[model samples]
Target: MDKHSIEKEFTALIQQYRNVIWKVCYIYAKDRENLNDLYQEAIINLWKGFPKFRKESKPSTWIYRIALNSCITFFRRFSRHPQTLRLTESWDFAYEENVFSSQIQELYALIHCLGNIERALILLWLEEKSYAEIAIITGLSQTNVATKLCRIKEKLKKMSNQ
Candidate 1:
């Protein structure tokens, strides 16, 4: 595709999948500024992978793979980089007052404690994706996905009880 056509297609795909993208971003980002940076990283990776996309998988599955890989890589890098600055702006309660239900907010908080791969698996499970789909998106075998998810649930059960 030509440049303009590619841009249009990419824009349309992003618009269609924005919510899925944002959920992964919000789950992985540490703060507002980090979220913004991760969002851009995910989008850039998605755009780069667009041309090579084959119709062998669902678009959502393809997008999830790109988004999750970006999050995992960036999370590792950001954790290693001590000099990454937090936002200096005054505290905003706006996000605190946002419309997500308390249960979801609490879940997000709990999700932060798991290892990165665990978080991804639980996120996919919470989204109601099938094991086959999760395996494809995460590049794991279906059996491995099932086993890891079982372990993650046990971990979460312990975490919630503490």
Candidate 2:
């Protein structure tokens, strides 16, 4: 395809999958500012890879892979740096307000405590992606995905009870 076509398709794809991107980013974001930064990083990576994306996988599957990988990498990079400047005014209220309910907010808080891979796995599960699709995006075997998800659920259950 031509440059214009590629850009058009990419723009459409991003628009269509915007929620997926935000959900993935929100899972890894420490706060509002970090969420925006993670989103931008994911968009940049998606644009970079769009031109070369093979059609072997479904669009959503490809998006999940790219967005999840981008957020995970962003988290690792920022964790290593650990020198981000914070604003005096807080964005926590806005973040909480975006969530549908208190239970979801609490669930998110528990999810935040999970390790990066666990968070990613749970995010995919919450999105109702099939085990096969999760395996594809995560590069894990189907059996591995099932086992990890079971462990993650138990871990979350334990955390919630406490």
The per-model lDDT (C-alpha) reads 0.81, 0.85
Displacement of residue 31 (Cα, Å) in model 2 is: 0.6
Model 2 worst lDDT window (10 residues): 82-91
Task: Give the distance in Å from residue 1's predicted Cα in candidate 1 to where it truly belongs.
Answer: 2.5
lDDT of 1 at 124: 97
TM value for model 1:
0.87
Backbone clashes counted, model 2? 0
Query: Over 4 Å off in model 2, which ranges?
Result: 81-99
Task: Give the alpha carbon lDDT tens digit for every residue of 12-129 in model 2.
Answer: 9999999899889888888888888988999999999998898898999999999999988987776964332122323373443464566677787778778889999999999999
Tens digits of per-residue lDDT for model 1, 5-106: 989988999999988888888777777887778889999999999989986999999988899999999978768643321223222222423665555556
